[model samples]
Target chain A: MSDKDTTYQVPIGPIHPALKEPFMINFRLDGETIVDAEAHPGMNHRGIEFMGMHRNPLKVIPLSERICGICSIVHQHMFTTAVEHAAGIEPTNRARYIRTIMAELERIHSHVLWAGVAAHEIGFDTHLHFTWKVREKVMDLLEYIAGNRVNYSMWTIGGVRRDITEKMYPKVNETLDYYESLYKKLEEIFLGDPSIRLRTKDIGILTEEEALRLCGVGPTVRASGVKKDVRIDQPYAAYGDLDLDYVIPSRYGYENTGDVFSKTLVRLKELVQSIDLIRQCVDQMPEGDIDSEPKKAVLLNKLKKADGEGIGRIEAPRGEAFHYARLKEGQEELDCWKIRASTYNNLTTYAPMFMGEQIADIPIIAACIDPCIGCMDRAEIVEINSGERYSYTHEELHVLSVEKTKKILEGSL
Target chain B: MNTIDLPMSLDELESYFKEGLGDSISDLRKEEIKKGLNNRPVKLIWFTVSRGSFRKSIELISDIQIPHLSVTSGSDLGDVVELIYHFAVNYGYPGDEVSVNIKVHLPKDDLTIPTITDLVPGAITTEREKQEFLGIKVENIPDSRRLWLDEGFPEDRYPWRWDETGMENMSRYVHDKEEAANPPTEDTPREGGGKDE
Candidate 1:
């Protein structure tokens, strides 16, 4: 209580949107500068792993996709791959290519959707609307391929449930071409815009040492000069066949500051990278069956008798995530299933990033990680000395962020 | 963050561990799942280590490079809790990364494993998680306050355990009342793993 007498505690929380996974953070502040930020995630731990463990292997496929609303494909892909590896079922080469294409398309849409959120966080609604509008092409492409916008239930135990027929190639190419065309404009707006640079540059810096020491992943770590992309490091699916490089800030001559700006740069570049990867997969796709074991009963029987543990790690749009699965002989359900999302690894890195940022920078910094769920729903500022308590709604926090942008534009504190 | 000129293959890595921690390792397996046009090898080495040598094995891994700790995946195997430390090495090099999963089985009575947060600070999350979900005590974890589960939830009942301490009685399906109350958890055949979750 004595320490609180000289400091304030700002708890931002209950970022629970529609009862999905939620997150919260408590910021210890002296004046407007953040001294330390402690994150309290798991506000709504749905016990999906518990749910998965209770069901059969085939039944868990749909359940896995429901783990994350944004990256349903990532969970589905990882679950199937883990089960397949345990059961010793090799997916066809064509199926791997199809999976890769779908994963990349999801990345495009996720990153684009994040751009809008980041824009909104910084009070740039115009950019948010613009980016959201630009995001339709990728979402359309995903829906066209998988038949669903969000939960594209494409994965089966052995392989994908659907095929990317020759007829779909034209649509896929058109979508990729659309992103390629808009890439420069998207870059100019996010990276070239003066206001965004002012707000993001030198804000929420996570040094390379901290990034590595904390084991950060995906664009979050890549932005900090850590070359830890799962696609390149360990090629799963069609990533081995496709030539790719880590989308670190240094690749394009920008310093790896690990700030919000560098993170934005990394995600934007990854957008282009994903487009190129999908094109590579399309060009090099082999002709074969999409599903290795189409009959659910047959595959279920195989998984039930399989006795092994397997791992599926992927470079999700957010970062590196993995699913671990174990199947014992004669067991109808999984013996063990552990789902580790990228955010879990990146969670520790937040304390370092928020060390010296202003309270206004919290929203953008939190959004910069592109956490699976919205995290800035509301905030309560506790003046510890007086024991006075008041809160800021998500909209009020948005105003503070926008006001910071306006102050930067006006050249006044 | 010392750099080795050439990353060792999965075989060499396995041999390194066996030679270094001889009797501490068991059930050693090295696999490569080939994929796509190039048939590039995705290597993985699975080995179970004695509880005493768990930290020692991690120290051996750090000798090569600051291992990228993916996550520690674990489950309750009735008598012993099986904790698998899923780590990745040779990260910078393209297509050279090997997943080294070190399994440590602790008797339910002991239910304790030393923390690797000293070697991999990032492992605190997974360590704390293993502590809560499976009721495994993470000895000397820097900060052991509950991570995922809230303060109100019953601390004694771990969700992952399929035992008396587990949430089996509480975990249920809406329609399957009888099935939920008396769930089928039968064959714990090999190495103490259960038949079903």
Candidate 2:
């Protein structure tokens, strides 16, 4: 096609080499700048929310875990809390403390995962490998406590399913100490590297005004100088009791670009804060039943007339997760259950952020908000040729197979 | 901060709503429930009018507009589908929550209701998803685009349909197969499948 008749369109994903998931984005580019972008998110719509309404509360707990693998515990925590709130039962003090510990542990693991991904995005493979090696400590601790690496069904309706045993305290402490040392190493790598600063600083900048208008939550909002945190504003899960300081990125030493650099700094600082919070929970341990005795008589009686409405909001690793449930009398199932994740609220602003960014900076810009592409169930990539298309799975790119190398060597050598 | 006595009678709560919102209300009653539960005071009020009357209901409670729409939940209860619009009003002075349930019944075929999206933008996604999921058509909604409907789940397939999914059949077959394969033998009544047996 000649230049006069040709149109420049970049199709990203459904199958992309960079992205870890399946879904596509079509970007209409004009001279290295994105003019218009369309997002398609139905690649892995498992109908989890629809499944939640029909499944019994007990079964829904595990279903929630499958929503996002990285933040599996937080999903179950939010769902169980919503159910408990609807039933008008608050977990015991001991249970609340246990819940907080589990959540912070999740935050530690998730942030480490994000850091590794961010490093890999910027062509820093060594940093990625080292960070992930450190991240295994947290994952191992999770396994020891919950008996599984990923989908730990530790959260129950009224309280946590498993109590923190006395034997696990030392292991938890050792894990925290390891993470503390890892944090210092990551800070040195992220903050001290000139190439990383050049790549990330002042790129994908989200101003305070834009952040507020877009209703961006969590670290994205915090990096933009918004001091609002759900844990501080509406304290839950023993966060109110813990005397920990909210970590906000400082504008002084680092350039307050409100870009990916600032966001990375904020997440790194929060990692340190999470480590401290875990230590506090372990030290100031409370004594009581991890779960209150089941109110069988009340539940059975209420099961007949137990129709009520309740809203449960929790600050998950990504952002605030809202669950609304209503019970109808004499109904064997819930009348209605509505859920809104933080990512659902944040996706509205992606178009505005992607508008003026250079085509080369798309990955870093998207990662600035700590974009959970998996949550969106979508991918973002650019197609260079019109008729020719290329695609690769995440396993092929991230986890290189032996066959890939054998073919390449056979051809080249 | 009005502290209503515990287990307040249905008549007493009706008078409170009438006095609170100066409008002549009717059909205020306690929803039927099983006994032996910890009974918290609740009142359901149904307006004796059409969709336009919702504005009047809103105006009556304008003074107490602190009410948050907990959720706009719809369900297909087999016979007559029900749309339970739950609103919880938080009085600053009182530390308690006063929940009011406005129940509207729509015929199974024509499950259309005037959209409340204009009143609350947050309700837009929930209402649209419900319309697409349960085949409840919410009229006047801004974005009528199918949210999760692109999955070829079929219109009104309602993944929650237990009879259609045949989970019972699957569970029964699996259970029967397990029982037959490992029938409790007299030598090993507990079915431990010991080497001796």
Model 2: fnat (fraction of native contacts):
0.08
True contacts kept of 1: 0.80
Candidate 2's error at A248, in angstroms? 3.4
TM-score of candidate 2 on Cα atoms, chains taken together: 0.71
lDDT (10s digit) by residue, model 1, range B1-197: 45545578977887789998999899999999998789999999999999999989999988888778999988888788899999999988899999999999999888888888988989999898988998988889999999998676676778899989887666653234444344445452223324364
Off by over 4 Å in 2: A1-7, A15-19, A244-246, A250-257, A294-305, A375-413, B1-131, B134-143, B155-197
Which candidate number maximizes TM-score?
Answer: 1
Give the residue spans of candidate 1 off by over 4 A.
Answer: A1-4, A16-21, B1-4, B173-197
Report how far off residue A153 is in candidate 2 (Å).
1.7
How displaced is residue B134 in candidate 1, in Å? Answer: 1.0
The models' CA-based lDDT, in order, is: 0.87, 0.62
lDDT value, residue B47 of candidate 2: 32
Task: Please estimate how well model 2 matches the true structure, expressed as its whole-model Cα lDDT.
Answer: 0.62
